[model samples]
Target: MEQFSTMFLSFIDTWGYVAVAVLMGLENACIPIPSELILGFAGYLISAGRMEFFHATVAGMIGGMVGSIVTYYVGSHGGRPFIDRYGKYFFMKKSHVDTAQRWFDKYGVKAVFFSRILPVVRTFISLPAGFARVNMKKFIIYTFLGSLPWTMFILYIGWLLGDNWKSMLAVGHEASLIVATLIVLICLFYFIRYKRNKKRL
Candidate 1:
């Protein structure tokens, strides 16, 4: 993990905020880059006085918005036909999409904010939001607001850990697993209840 940390740290150190923005944008665009690593390393740079905390954080947030906007437009343009043709390849399940849409329906704007921080949910939640034709201004606002805490959190870990930022791999993974498991359990509970309710009808 140190190897990966070093790599991303190099990018941030060498290219400064540009690296943070580009890589963060790619991550939010679902490009498989880990934000924990990116923001964490930037945090480490802050400790070393290699980067400023505010600048790094802002770049990350902006980049995330940029990537999310791109992804949002893709889904908005694609709609159901796009999902029908390519959903599986994107790791999207109809049940999950339905749940997202339903949640968005009930919660309105808060769903976007919450989704931005919920592990795997954050990545693909935008698709359903876009598919449901959510208001663009509200979507953008909520998405950015939701992402700020997460970015600050991971980066804060990096800042505190200094050279030991590599240690975050274990810490982050363990925390993420616990959160993800809880989310899965909650979803399963609701799913089962819905099934029973449907049967009763």
Candidate 2:
């Protein structure tokens, strides 16, 4: 954990917007880089008069699009077998993949937009959307729309808490754990509900 914080802080300090962009993009690629940390730190930077919130948000959005594009293509061309094989490498389970597909089927393009606001679910959502061959234009549009607001909201949190930047590493670690737990619980609940629905059918 100390090593991670050290590395992350070094990256943020040295690369600034570039670091934020790359981190956010990597997050989309299922690399476990939390958007919350990046946005929050960026917000803290803004409050410290180090960066503008608009620039930080835009950087995050662009990074997200690039990362999701990679996942989308992987889904579009890689097929189910490919996903099954590599899913674990990216911390994705087959059940999660299926759930994303179910949501995509049920909600169409809108799922792409809403999923961006979710935590762990967002990481795998684009893959199913790509697999389902959602309209490329619509997919990009919705993804941007959904992710942009989230990016801003998180950044705002950091901005509001700028005085605590020195201790952000610890705070971020705890916040991340909490958010991850919540996301897992949400997914579990939905998974059980879906299974019940399927059984009833």
Candidate 3:
């Protein structure tokens, strides 16, 4: 842990603010960089007097927003055909994407707003929203609103936890798994009931 802290601090010393922006942006861009560590590292920097709180927060938000815009455009322009051809590399299947699209359609802007804070959902919600051709202006607005609090909260964690930041990431990952499992179970139950009702009819 001490070695990691040293290496990370070294990174901050070398790249400064741009590294924060780029890492956070890639996280949103589906590159699998965990925001927990990304923002946490920034927070640690702040606590160590190497970074400013406002600068780190703003950079994180800006980086995340930029990455989200890129994802939104990819979903909007490429559409399903692109996904059908290449999404498997990302472990995405058509039915899953279709389900997300339906949910987004039913919920509209609220889906995008909430998805920004919901674990893995935050990572891919833009795809279905883009496929549905949601308004770009509204999408950006809700995404920013959703991302702001998440950024602030996670950055706070990093600042607070300091050397123990890695542990928080583990806990977050496990929590995401639990939430995902619950969602799957709920969906499965709903599907079974719907099918049974159809048979009765």
Candidate 3 Cα errors over 4 Å, as ranges? 1-13, 88-103, 173-201
Query: Per-residue lDDT tens digits of candidate 1, residues 91-186?
Result: 566666666667667777678887776655566677767777778999899898778877887788889999998787657656455544655687
Better of 2 and 3 by TM-score: 2
For model 1, the superposed segments whose C-alpha errors exceed 4 Å read: 1-9, 83-108, 173-201
Q: Which lDDT tens digits does candidate 3 get at residues 1-201?
A: 557546555665679788888877877876656777778778877877888889998998999999888878888899979988988786565665676576687888678876776766677778887887889999999889878877877777777877776667778766445544655576699999999999999
Compute the lDDT for candidate 3. 0.77
For candidate 1, the 10 contiguous residues with the lowest summed lDDT are 175-184
Q: What TM-score, to 2 decimals, does candidate 3 have?
A: 0.75
**CA lDDT, candidate 1, residue 11:** 82
* TM-scores, one per candidate: 0.73, 0.77, 0.75
Pairs that collide in candidate 3 are none
Ranking by lDDT: 2, 1, 3
The Cα local distance difference test for each model comes to 0.78, 0.79, 0.77
Whole-structure CA lDDT of model 1 = 0.78
